[model samples]
Target: MNPARAPQSVPARLAQIALYGVAAAAVAGLVALIVSAVLNGSLTRSGTADALGWGALILGFLSGAVAYSQSGQSRIESTMRARLGEGYRAPGLPWPQILAPLIGAGILSAIVFALN
Candidate 1:
C-alpha cells in the first residue's frame, strides 16, 4: 500500500470537495465585500443597508456550513442507512477543523450585520 495514496471513498471525496468549494466561495465573498466597501467610500444608510443584505447572505452560508460540519457525518450515515439499508459504511470528513474559519466568519458577520 502506498502511504501517499490512501484510497478515499466517494462520499469522503465529495465531502472534501464540498468543504473546499465553500471555503473558496467564502473567501471570494469576503474579498468582494471588502472591495465594495473600499470603492463605495462615502456609504449612505442605503449603501450600508446593501452591505447588511450581503452580510445576511454570507451569514446564512456560514451558519449552514457550520451546522453541516457539526452533524454531516451523522446525517450521511442516516441517509445511507435509509437509502442503502444498514451496514453501509464510508469515510467521513474532518469537518469541525475544516469549517472553523466559516464558523468564525459566521459569528463575526452576524455581529457586523446586527450592528449595521
Candidate 2:
C-alpha cells in the first residue's frame, strides 16, 4: 500500500460518501425550498424554516460524521491527510477539520440565498 494512502475498509469509505451525500442533499433541498419561496413571494415563513432546517441538518450531519470518523483507532487528521492529501486538518468541534469550513460556507450560502 502507498504510504500516502491509508488503508480503509470498503464500508468506511461507503459510509463517508453517504454522509457527504446526505449533507449535499440537505443543502440542495434547502436551496430548492428557498428558490421556490422567493419565486412565490413567501420568503418570510418559508425562508426562515428552510434556513433553520438546513442549519440544523448540516450541524447534525457534521456532528455525526465527525463522531463516526473518529470512532476508529485512527485519528481524523491522519485519515484526512491520507485520503485528502497533505495539509488536511479536521474541523473544529464535531467536524473533520477539512469539512468544517465547507459545511459552514454551504449553510451560510443557504441562509443568504433564502434571505435574498
Worst 10 residues of 1 by lDDT: 96-105
Which residues of candidate 1, in runs, are more than 4 Å off? 42-116
| Whole-structure CA lDDT of model 2 | 0.59
| Tens-digit lDDT track of model 2 for 1-116 | 78659877887865675567456646655675676577767756656656556664655566567666665435656686787767654543543443543555466556656665
State the local distance difference test value for candidate 1. Answer: 0.60
Q: Residues 1-116, candidate 1, lDDT per residue (tens digit)? A: 89769998888876775666456546645664676679897565556556645654664576577667657777777787978767655556555454644544554455456756
- Which parts of model 2 have CA positions greater than 4 angstroms off? 1-4, 43-116
> Candidate 2, which ten residues in sequence have the lowest lDDT sum?
92-101
- Using Cα atoms with residue i matched to residue i, what is each candidate's TM-score against the true structure? 0.37, 0.34
Candidate 1 residue 77 Cα shift, in angstroms, is: 42
TM-score of 1: 0.37
Candidate number achieving the greatest TM-score relative to the actual structure: 1
